[model samples]
Target: MERLQKILAGAGVASRRKCEELIQSGRVQVNGETVTELGTKADPAADVITVDGKTVGAQKKMYIVFNKPKGVITSASDPQGRKIVTDYLKGINERLYPVGRLDYDTEGLLLLTNDGEFAHLLTHPKHHVAKTYLATVKGVPHGTALDKLKNGIMLEDGMTAPAEVEYYDIDPEEKHATISITIYEGRNRQVRRMFEAIQHPVTKLKRISFGDLYLGNLKRGLYRHLTKEEVEGLIKLARTAGKPGNRPTPKKDK
Candidate 1:
């Protein structure tokens, strides 16, 4: 049996994650019964599956990298009717969804795809691919502050994993700085909130890289298909990340 979302993704409905939303929203029917749980599964060969009353069929997978512009919602659609990431994908025929999300005001690299397994591989917790960002903040961080940020900062949600933080530029007045940070986790508003925890709220934030993929001169609000090499590199990185860690050390001598 295949997972409901996986089956939908392969049928070109959307990415696996987006398919989960369909399930949760009570729009997915399997053999004429609604399945709302994420773990629901069925044999696509036998089960008559439909999404929002439309039957699904095998479809080609698609991938692209979007240079998301500020003020656009990262979601496929917004209840408020604000422009969303999907609005920018007017010319693309296949249904695709953002791999992860960038905040409405945050600008930079965003990945979109209809490949469910590929999306799962990239966003899985064990495959927390490093993401690099450039952030303009309100104050220059002292060594102590920078150290705390690098080691880990305690946020209301939890302790952040270790990160790499450095000053990219500091104003002569020492009042503001452009900081570069690389982090593995992609919690909601994490970078902005991390700085806020350190008393240097971010004024501007832009992701420059995601694993092997780079924003690289893509004009704002425009997108491009990823090169074959870049896609291969991400698969390689995810494979490496998903490997089991070396077994725990043998019990030490007493």
Candidate 2:
């Protein structure tokens, strides 16, 4: 049994802190009785739960791969008044959120899901989920600059782990080069920052591949569910790279 508030929060009802307020305000009920207790527990699968008179049930777990278009925010909501990725998924019934994050200016493959455990597994750094990107930068980084990126660059938090970087193409006249970079670590704006460190700012960044998943032919703003094989591959990869004490045991999906 899990705390009622945590269940509600995990269902995207509200944050845990806000769920506490909702409970205290008598807006929550369990098994047809108003529950104002802060520490109320309920079996999400069996309990009759409601919030503000609307029945609350366990949401169906959904996993979707989206070919995210540029200029759309990855977040569910943006205070800065910008278009969000959720706006494109209007017909979808499930309330899904982007698994990790891709900046507004960056584009390409992104995963969206309501499975909190799966999201945690994919985003947690200890999993070492590899992300590959195709970046077009202002300058062609050669020799020493390439070495620095491949070896590792010192960031504000600490030194980044070694990355795989190779040139896709170079246009000397335009002073730009298309480079492929694969990173196992996810820090905030890491790909962009890595290029900036070498004085070769990235003009465009698109994640081409993530683990065993790829953008394929999915058009921008379109999404599709992962195949059974794809899901199994990801679970295996996560288990292999997950932290020593926190590795997730593979479970059969119903």
Candidate 3:
């Protein structure tokens, strides 16, 4: 028997942490009895598990790489009726949610999948999966500003970890520059905020790569299934990086 949250996560209900919240909130029922204990375990094959009165079982896992267009929400659905990432996936029958988030005004590579465990493994802060972004900012920052980003930046939340910054070309007339920044954290609007901290607010942003997956000319609003090798590689990377002593110390502002 496996933990109920694990079963629910494996069945695509939500991430393991979210599933725990559902259980504690009394939204999860097993064999017609409400269970609120985090330690509760059940045999998925034999037990009748229902979340919010809807039965859940093992589903055929699907992994997709999407090139999200700007102005599209990264959620499964939006109450405001704005366009969502799933709106691009018209024919896909499986219920998939984005593994992480991209801002509504930022476009780039995003992953959608029904495998909640996979989502948690990659997104949990301890994993430190690297994500690279190409940011076009308003002004050309000097070496000192770029060094601030490379070492760390103090944001609203706190001090950011050291990032990999690649200085690219600048448009002399436009007073703008395109720089590539890679970060391990998935904080909300992190890249944009990082540039803003350096007095170079991002005018445009696009995620170029996530871990082993590259966006590579995938047109905006289009998506494709992940190959077996790509999925395995990502899982291996996350697992390896999550091991003890593998995580990086968040750089303090000096």
Candidate 4:
């Protein structure tokens, strides 16, 4: 028997965490019985499971990389009537959700997948998946600003983890200078906040890479599935990081 949340996530029901919430809210039924427990288990090969009275089973897994455009929320829906990332995935039959998130104004590479276990591993704080971004700030930062970001900076939540920063020398004649930043943490508005702390507000931010994945020439709002090698490498990394018995934490929106 496996945890119900993991099974649901693997089955493309939702992320493991969100599945747990469904259970708690009395939306999930297992073997014809409502299961409201957080760590409930079920046999995927045998037991019948349902969410909101709909049968639940593993669906075809999909791994898509999207070059997200600015102004789209990284969510399945928005009650405020705003456009969400799902709007860009018009033809996909599988119900996939974004792995982590990009702020509404930020744009670039975003992963969408129905493989909840993989999503958990990629987004979990302990795994430390590095994300690289190209940022254009209002003013060019000096050595001190860069050093502060590398060491750590104080935020409202607490001190942030150290980040990797490098200047991007594009055209010297360009009005705005570009900088590359790599961070392991995924705190809300982290990249922007870090620069703001040093008096250099970010004008534009685009994530160029996430973990081993790169945004290779994909234009804005386009998406593609991850290559087999990339998927395997991610699986290996998750296993190496000790993801214990395939039991994933319940999914919550990041």
Best by lDDT: 3
TM-score of candidate 3 on Cα atoms, chains taken together:
0.92
Tens-digit per-residue lDDT, 197-233, candidate 2: 9999999999877776878778888988998788788
Candidate 3 residues 12-78, lDDT tens each? 8888889999999999999999999998999999999999999997898899999999999989889
Best by TM-score: 3
Error of 1 at 110 (Å): 0.6
Error of 2 at 79 (Å): 2.9
What lDDT tens digits, residue by residue, belong to model 1 across residues 1-254? 99898898877787677788999999999888989999888998888999989888777777899999989999877999999988888799887888888998899999998887787888887886878888899988787998888888999999998887777778999889988888888799999999999999999998888886778878889998888888889888887873222212121112
Q: What is candidate 2's CA lDDT for residue 123?
A: 77
For candidate 1, report its TM-score. 0.83
Worst 10 residues of 1 by lDDT: 244-253
**What is residue 7's positional error in candidate 4, in angstroms?**
0.7
- Candidate 2 regions exceeding 4 Å error are 1-42, 49-55, 172-174, 242-254
TM-score of each predicted structure versus truth: 0.83, 0.79, 0.92, 0.89
Model 3 poorest ten-residue lDDT run:
245-254
Residues forming the 10-long window of minimal summed lDDT in candidate 4: 244-253
- Kindly list the per-residue Cα lDDT of model 4 for residues 1-254, writing each as its tens digit: 99998998899888888877888999999888999988888999899999989998768888999999999999999999998998999799888899999999999999999998889888888887778888888767787888899888999999988887767744465555577888878899999999899988889999888876778788899888898899888767655653222322211212
lDDT of 1 at 52: 87
